[model samples]
Target: MRLTLASYGLLTGIVLVVVVPFLVAVSYRAEQRQPDLSPERIIAASQGAFAPAIPPAEDLAVLELAAEQGIALAQNNLAVILLRTRDSRNHDRADRLLEAAAAQGLVQARYNIAYRIPYRFNTDPALVERQIDLLQRNVAADDIHSMALLAARLGFENRERFVEDRQAEQLALLQNAAATGDPDYLFLHGAELVDRVRNMPPSDHSPARLVVMELALEAFLASFEQGEPRAAQRISAMIAERNVGALTDRLAAMGLPTSDLEWLDMAGQAGLAYADCHYARKVLGDLWPDDLMTEPLYRISAGIVQDALTHPPERRQRALDLAEACATPPQIPEFRPRAFGHTALYLAKHRGGWPAIGDSRGQADVMLGVIAALGVFGPVDREKAAFHFDRAVRVHDYRGGVGFLDRLD
Candidate 1:
């Protein structure tokens, strides 16, 4: 019981070291167990702080804490999670939370509210009007996505009410959105233009209408350049709609002469795969010179062809002769193999013979089968036709399936 002052101090120091560490560890564990509702923590968690590895439950705890304290971002995020849960009570709560966030002028929350109003909430006329008001506000704020969605909804879905009744306003909204050069908006604007062109009466087909259609095509090309995947399909459709004469006229209007291959070359260089195929076809038809021709030769041939059109019969033969002498065998165009293969199969089926250009073994066999079956290049030989058809079928040519079925019958 008789301890010296030095002994007492040593005992107290030892107790403090052990107790201090235990108390700190306990406090840290308690803090970790509870959700942190600090503004920084709420903002980070709202932005997916837990990320891919953590479960939703951990994220929900932190979000709930912040949302209960009226944090708009947290409210919006928690609303989204609740919406995904599919619980009826949570659905109502989520809608209320979204409305609360939107009332705070959160753009994303407004977008979500506008999107969900017609579908998730009952589509009352008042609610629809409210959603439209929010979308208009967002559009006025230069939110491009809202502009696109609103345009589609009003101009396409509720045309009679929102678009036809206010045509000029709707058009302005669509044009403004497209003017941003955003790929999605550009595609949508192009599509709307296509619809307008399609609906125009024959009597309405003036030069102005033609210019509008050309602008639509340019929009599609621009959208394709901006990485819109579906834009290529639209360009192909537009090309398919016009004949060579119409295309030539359009090119001439643009100050690009149709006598040369410049238009096709430009399109091909712009990543239009079908343009290369079309150019290859034109070369085979002698409508355009082969790519192997020297630039001077090409120009000379083009000039001769152009002159032949205006020349009298006596002079025309000489022009034709000069052009023919300048011509060379066509080379396979880059990016044309797949389209060429398909074209070869199409010619064999419809024209009764394959084009001498565009050679592929599978397509060649299909062509041979068709020729043999139809007596195109020789006497009909069903057995030989059947043999080629079988080979084509084995190679997964779906067209061969039709021939194989015919042979079996």
Candidate 2:
């Protein structure tokens, strides 16, 4: 009886040893959601909240395993990763994935043709021409955006043979885009008209010119009414550039309620004074080249651009003079130079801005402030410079130079 019990005990011990390990392995496998995600020779210390010191290999392995498991996002991510690798090894695969995403109408994929969507892509002459052809055929095709892009490309170009269609297309796209009230399109359309008028030929007095200008104004108004701050100032600029007939007279013809006559020259008052002959003439009329201007403001306050080489530079200067006339503020205070930039920063002086000034003098103050802010224009007068810089920074936010840092220094 004693011998039989001993034999049973030995058998039980063997079974326990084999079954324990098997049970532990099963439980471990069940607990794992993805992969073990471990690397050799890594130890953990204190970890931060929202941060984990997972091994790089472990993450890669888990993600790779997930992709193999047929996860959609993982698959998409893997496709992008392969494409971005920019290696001969994965380019074909990446291209296929990107195409697939594009086929799905993914917005990111739509933006992936090149890193940039505008001039960077359309600037290619062949590509733009092709897009124009496609748009001429259809705008709501699977690639309706082709028309949008083509119109956008030509807005600033103004090629002669295709002017009518391009303008029509541009108007359609801009109007459609405007319905959504997107500022970028408004700004782009405005900028394009400005460029076109700045380049139009003096002999090219087509009625289309006037229509395009009106379109630009109305477009700007739409955006302005939506609460863009610079709308009035930009319109004022357009007004000052016009030689359509006369400002007060033309606007008065409509018999609509309006602001003071003085405010008609708001852009000039805003300190965007000075003109090349072309723009100046349109803005200031006969006085565009210098003589002081009052009343009888140019009706079409937008400048029509002419060929730079066709018209002599002096003519351009004359035009600028007209525009400069628009800058005739009621009372512009002068300032001392050397008050800003290097002198102010390195010399440590408080030339102005010690106290706040109210609304009444704001216009003139701002005008002087503009002259001062654009310090590189004239002689260095510290006191005046400081006032200008201070005003520019405090009031208008010094937009002219803010972008300088982003430019190649």
Candidate 3:
């Protein structure tokens, strides 16, 4: 019996020495094999947030693993990706993820949820209340995004039907957001101030109107200087209507663009496509130039484009000849389309004079057809355009559509 007990003790000792160390080593190796889910690592893997492009499969896998591991930021960003997909099932998952993130104190998730609510003067009472509540909470936390969003919601329209002091609240929020000197918020604040002055009674003769106008002008100028090109358009419009006295002098004094054309040019260079289009029309007319084309040929082609309708048959044919002579590879890619479109318009109108102008018109139509068919100009009809836009949206091309697509209708 003594020898058996001693044998058991010796076996127990051997088991502890071998099994415990084996278990410890296995645990250490398992931990070492686990991928890092640190904030920096997850953020680096996150994609499809600010960009139009979808994240690659590898990135999605990394994000999925991190999100599954309970990373709130990863969940929020993945929610954004799902929401952008616009699939109904994906939207449900996105909402759940956003709620989870918001529960974890992610303010951006709350702001995003509130931003999706449609504001129609409190037409939907439940949604309005929910949005207001969410935004108010976020605003209390001093979130600039929430402040701007809440301001927009409250000040949208029909304030009298809602809270009596909603306007004051909205203004306060705008002022707070604009105080941060963000160009977008500054522009919004300026627009709101302009609305205030417009709504005031004319006979009131309140010095407040002048003060508000001045403040708005300052906001617009600051916003424009900070890379908000639309603010320049606002200032130019105000100047054109003589809405603000001595606006041109003030602009000149500040070494800013004083003339309408000057403002348009500045805005154009700042990447406002509308301003660019208008400025190009004002400077170059409807005509577009080919690469390495001489200034004389450009001017003549522009004249032909503008005066094609009034020109005699012989002169029209001569103008077509000049245009053909001016044709070469397109220098300005943007102008290529307009050149083709305008040339086609001229050809269509001059069909009675030159029936054999097929080659010139055919080239233009070929280019225009390619552009139109590829959905650059949206669609050949409204129905197709809507479908194209809808598909583009579903594929996460909303921003790209707005930025790159032009609607013919």
Candidate 4:
């Protein structure tokens, strides 16, 4: 049994050659394999919750791995991320992932793929038709997102016949999704309700039509409550319509409680330009007090006049010229002194004023006259300013102010 040194060395060399490679291969494989690849683990890691002692993988890499392992959610999520890149290669991969996920009966994946191929851009009619078919299936399954998307795209793909089919189907889809409490859906639903009312037969006296109109109003109110700015404007328009048209009696008969003023206040608070401007006009309208000296408008005008008086003559004249330009009605609406003055005039012209100056421009003329007489924007011109005030007193029946004749002329 004695072995020679050469034979022993040859046996050791053979063992090293085989065993070392096998050990190295096993270590490499172990390093490459993940400790956990479950859907939860994949999602957690993607969201930055890493397992202890495991090397962190990029979110996309983890999702890709889980997707390849046939996790439908991972596939759908990965495809969503890929689709956002807008790269053609990524889009192709995303399409395949979406297809795979959809085939596994994921409702969102079906909608995602259908939404991805917008018929507007996709020239392939067959492909567009397929997407429509998929969307219709999802809609039938009561997928709210699919209903909204299909409602939008239904007529966009096909001919006039498809467009004609939109009225009932689109309205139904919008109405169904409206209760989902999504602001956009509520707005669309309100708009559809309005359209239905507009198309009602004129001679039809169905209480149901009034109910539908009331529903339209309700939808707009709900949308505004949900913080949609456009809804505020619509409500304002409705209020105006009620005030101007004979529909006021009709709508009021329905006991439709309109929050016209309340909605205007909210719209003003939310910084809507038109509503805010209207609010400013309302405030200014109430500003005609017994003592003009106590008014904020009077004080602001006095300060400007004081500032101009302190300047040297030439500089005062230049500043006065600029101030005069500023005093004119601004091309753009805003809440400034000029705006207050202009709005006073606008209200006096379009809406009747206090009973003393009823249906006349007297109140506005007096404001303008006083502004000019005090040199709020230019040199004090008693003669020029008195013209408007005196004319209002004589012609327009304005006796609110004593003409400030001594102060003016």
Best by lDDT: 3
Q: Model 2, 1-409: lDDT tens per residue?
A: 9999999998888879998889998998888753442321111110110122222554445545544554433333434444433376665754455445445544333333322223443366664454355444434443323334545556555342444665666766655655466554564566556657767997777888877776676666665556543444455556656465443354567562233222333323333242122243332222121211221212211212223234556754443344334323335544212111110011011111111222212223333332333332245344663454354456544322222212212
Clashes of each: 0, 41, 0, 0
Each model's Cα RMSD? 14.9, 16.9, 15.3, 16.7
Q: What is candidate 4's lDDT per residue for 1-409, written digit by digit as tens? A: 3568889988989889998899999999998885566666655544321212222456667787878988877777666655544379987997898889889977777777776665574457776777777778888898766777777666453523433566678888888888887766777777667667767877766777767766777777687777876566566556655322334454467664344544555664554544543432332232152545444555746654555465456644433333233223335443211100110010000010111213224554555466667666568777766775676577556654453645333
Find the candidate with the highest TM-score and give its number. 3
Estimate the TM-score for candidate 4. Answer: 0.52
Candidate 2 lDDT for residue 44? 17
* Residue 189, candidate 1: C-alpha displacement in angstroms: 1.2
Cα lDDT of model 1 by residue, 1-409, tens digit: 4578889988889879998889999999998887667766655555442232322566678888777888887787767656554469987997898888888987767776776755333356677677778888988788766676666546434434533555456556667877999776777777778777778886675777777677787776677678664455555555556433564477468664454334444544555444444443343222221321333433433543454455455434432232222222234443311100110010000011111223233434544454456554348788876776566556534243243325324
Q: Which of the two candidates, 1 or 2, achieves a greater TM-score against the reference? A: 1
lDDT of each: 0.56, 0.42, 0.60, 0.58
Clashes of 4: 0
Poorest 10 consecutive residues by lDDT, candidate 4: 343-352
* TM-score for each predicted model, relative to the true structure: 0.52, 0.38, 0.64, 0.52
Q: What is the TM-score of candidate 1?
A: 0.52
